[model samples]
Target: MTPDEYAAALDAERSARNDRARYVVCEEHGAHALMRRNGSGQAWGVARHVSQETAELAAAFLNRLKEDEA
Candidate 1:
């Protein structure tokens, strides 16, 4: 990779661990859930919801790294 591409890749990896959430869809269950990236780079479920808004709200809270807590 070029210098810029390598830097961008590193930044993306850092963001995924620090402050990122995924909107997971469970088609089998017909529901959506908020999945947060854990310290160990695993998918951690925060909450499940039938609506998009609620799931996103939960993701917002779980994804942020509080300055006080950090």
Candidate 2:
């Protein structure tokens, strides 16, 4: 997805009350990374990679991460 599309999706996910945490696919230094915001609202990369495949994997990982935390 385009950067704007990613941003919209991230915003929507973050706003959803059911979502225990938010995951974002963002560009950094010409590459994409999966990020999550800390309790302090600072974005940090959970996984960094240059491929969309890795981003998809990161999304799945985020789901499991939430479940584990619960």
Candidate 3:
């Protein structure tokens, strides 16, 4: 799937959750890594790894998607 599509899917899943949470996407070793963040903006754990492009897309869309969901 394309990076934007992947990011949309992730945002949808995150929006479906019952609690307020956030995620940070980063590039690691030529791959994308997702890190879960708590309400206080602290990193909790790494969730998954995706493509570098996907990570870039996700980072770009994260805030916009959250605002849209709100």
Which candidate wins on lDDT?
2
Q: 1-70, model 2: which lDDT tens digit per residue? A: 9999999987776556335356778878877888886555677788788897788788778867775554
| 2 against 3, candidate with superior TM-score | 2
Question: In order, how many clashes per candidate?
Answer: 0, 0, 0
Pitting candidate 1 against candidate 2, the one with the higher lDDT is: 2
Q: Distance from true position, residue 14, model 1, in Å? A: 10
lDDT of 1 by residue, 1-70 (tens): 9999999998777765455434343322667766655455577565678987777666666445342233
Error of 3 at 57 (Å): 0.7
Question: What TM-score does prediction 2 earn?
Answer: 0.51
What TM-score goes with each of the models?
0.46, 0.51, 0.40
- Candidate 1: where is the Cα deviation over 4 Å? 1-28, 39-41, 65-68
lDDT of 2: 0.74
Q: Which one wins on TM-score? A: 2
Error of 2 at 9 (Å): 28
| Residue-by-residue lDDT tens digits, candidate 3, 1-70 | 9999999998787666524666678666666777666666677535445576666566557756765775
Model 3 CA lDDT for position 24: 75
